[model samples]
Target: MTDQDDLLPIGLEDALPARAAAITRAMRAVLDTMDAHGYDRVRPPLIEFERSLAGRMQGVATRRMVRFTDPESLRTLALRGDMTVQVGRIAATGLAEAPRPLRLCYAGEVALLRADQLDPARQRLQMGAELIGSDAVSAASEAVLLAIASLEAAGLSDISVDFTLPDLVDVLADEALPLAADQRDAVRRELDTKDAGGLAAAGGQAYLPLLYATGPFAEAAAKLKALDAGGELASRIEGLEAIADRIGGRARITLDPTERHGFEYQSWFGFTIYAAGARNAIGRGGTYTIRGSEEAATGFSLYAEPLLEASGNAREAARDTLFLPLGHDTAIADRLRAIGWRTIAAIGESDDPRALGCSHRLEGSEALPV
Candidate 1:
């Protein structure tokens, strides 16, 4: 039986040895891939002033952040639920004068105050790269391609991207479909849930075509084009075409133009990426204007846990290990380690090399299979 004192809270747990190794390997691969692409890595503090944290991003829900009064500043400090906001702040303040289209990547643990029904964990590992100062089609394309590269480096295959227009409602409501002010929010809510009945109830029956304009990219994009009776969506449609062309055959592409579920602040374009074996999206990215600086940026955030799950390995194959018995030559062991051998020294003469996960026994200076 487990003791009450040893019980963990509902949404948190330790990653045992093997799992930790997998997460570490995945993190390294992702960060290295981003670095190779000239995305400088940044490490932001886990907690920041609640106001500063909340002020930098539009969709960041302060209610979902774990907050507490800081004894030193007497101001509220909040654990970050996302690192993209902090990256935005960095680009706006510290690197404000950096050249246009600054690139930054980060990996960190984020905690939420409460878990949602669909996603149970309140804490998760988020990794992302932000391209600051540009939300143009080229920037969007780069973000999408880089996201695929990073996930691929982390050992995921058969990745798919579902694209969205975060501001689809606002754009149509403004002119093309002209919705009443009171009906706008209801329409967005209904569409987010894919509820056709609720959409009509909310006075958005005119926008019903958007519901079916979701599927394979080629088909959905064509449907979306036909639905645009006016030329209001012409530019947006063209931009999507440009991005999809850039993607080529690298990933499976689909379009859900009105998907506003996890996207709170993306502007023209957004995407949720999924691996073949994952149940939910492993990453999401899009274009947005940074809140404080009002500068355009494109970025994506990927979760490590989902990446590991989709990769289907809690740990990788065991590496070749050498066991050193008592009184073994220390210098020889050092040489073996330097040459890529993993050495585990015996504590006693009776210690079994196989039990210690050592594939070879260090007999004298040579490693021989046990």
Candidate 2:
């Protein structure tokens, strides 16, 4: 092969053996947990017609998609940049008549034209669950709780969740301090950066208190209530409080009422999950409306790469592969597997099992340390 053919494009990567095994194990654990919770698994295509994938969500930018023309159909096709959108499409068309509060889960790879600052890889492994046909608080609460459980099942510890009211700014601005679109954008940018002065200068003084209302759930809720904002703003805060109450003593929970980025489509509540050692968020999701319909859905997608990084225990456990001698008994191999050992039979003569990345080796009737 030529040198050019051997090089991979920027933002793309090949997951080597160790990392690949860890990712597979993590994803399987998460999917199994979701299945236990009654979330039916579904596999969506990696590519679809451009319009169908984009749907009506304003957050799904066309430039971020890797698009090309299909030769056979003479139509534009694009690699899916977000699996949530595909799941939404599935609920709307294929599973439209399934049932109320349909629970679905999916895990797949998505390619993006650009990556965010926190996650630099454009190609990502996204594993998540979605609940459709219900906008009730119970649905949102269940999604959040299930996400925490899945991350724990993947062997992550000290997991914490930060809740965001994506529509809080708009609700406050519309009711208390009406501003033009540009002014609202400026205020949002200021709030995102925690620039109190910029927010006040941009005619968002009424919403300035939100800058300080970010911390532990109870403390932040108290500060928010003190802002004296009533109507929908109050209702949104109450909803967040309700979610917190439901998730009590399950996982560490915090509140960030002013966060607006990365949740362009979420309607009421948005959230992000963090682990003890990871440098970036492990997952994020919230309540959103499937485009062209009023059905409310809530779910999250966990980034496998980062989760695997934070889960040191998972990596160590994945490395415990056992090497079996050539022509070893098949029944013994089956029994070893039943006891939670990953055994690989030797194909040819070899002196060292370590050369083949096996931690243990089988000798006669008993397995010996390598």
Candidate 3:
């Protein structure tokens, strides 16, 4: 048998040269815009104590994190799967007394257990930002603008940002239909899948005739208004609409009345960008308030691998250059190194001129006998 003690081959990734170069260049452009807007960069280590990764994220995300035992103290440790949670911990512990509103940015590889139907590799390169302890509309607007600017900088065209106010869904569902917890969850799941028939069944369409109706935002809003949604829920829906109106309707906007359901921590508006007809969303983010701490946060993460695949702007392959020395010229090597050029020393008479650029015809040298 092969040595059992041998380390398992690295499964996650080795970003191919071209892909790595492209990702680096793209990230630089995106991060530059972030820096210009007053968001300072923060580099958090890849590994932290297990409890550090344990705040606010769903159980799924928590379980996927790779864990180990510390050799010195035998404390449980884990590879951080998401930066935002770590950033939150940093804010809670490190920056507790620092400031009211903090703006931070990060670009790093995150490890997530491969979800079903994903490649076996768990490593993912992500670039994202966090705005903590702020609930202003301006902060939300800035987040949207940042998303637009970054995607455009990366050369993606015809991009559309879909803005959804998760609270609007909660308000509407609570007022329009008195759904039991299980029934409400089933309806939201079906709606998330955009399956009209399934959603109808989940909401018990015949008993609640309004459940099946679906369409553009205007139509949905009209339906809600017609239902005579009253009190705080109604006011919250109007408040959300005014926020959307303030966004100038320029962004390709959509309202999924079911938005607030899945991500338990999502507190307010949630938006995601989709490149027309792409299977995966290009990016996703939203404002959320942590449950117990009541700390408000907003941010998003770009799926670098998919974004790179969809992005046509990956840097071109570096030009190949072969260095051939007819005789022996140590001087040529020195010059090439000085000018920052790629070079290879050719030996003997069998070197092919067609395969090389700027080949040298060297003369006598001690290294190669004259």
TM-scores, all models, native as reference: 0.97, 0.90, 0.75
Tens-place lDDT digits, model 1, residues 1-370: 6698698899988998899999999999999999999999999999999998899878788998999999999999999999999999899888999898899999999999998788889999999999998999999999999999998999888999999999999999988998999999999999999999999999999999999999999999999999999978889989998999999999999999989988888998999999988888999999999997899999999998789989996568879999999999999999889989999999988999999899999888788999
Worst 10 residues of 3 by lDDT: 361-370
User: Candidate 2 lDDT, tens digit per residue, 24-132?
Assistant: 8898999999999999998999999999888756588767889999999999999998898888888888999999788999999999887766666889999999999
Error of 1 at 283 (Å): 0.7
Model 3: per-residue Cα lDDT over 151-264, one tens digit each:
767766566665565554455465455667677667656656666688678863522333422345556656645654355345545644665666564455555544443345
Off by over 4 Å in 3: 1-11, 118-121, 172-176, 180-184, 194-228, 231-251, 260-262, 276-278, 317-370
Candidate lDDT (C-alpha), each: 0.93, 0.85, 0.65
lDDT of 1: 0.93
Which residue runs does candidate 2 get wrong by more than 4 Å? 180-182, 229-231, 318-346, 357-370
For lDDT, the strongest prediction is 1
Arrange candidates by lDDT, descending. Answer: 1, 2, 3
Clashing pairs in 2: none
- Top candidate, metric TM-score: 1
TM-score of 3: 0.75
User: In candidate 1, where is summed lDDT lowest over 10 consecutive residues?
Assistant: 309-318
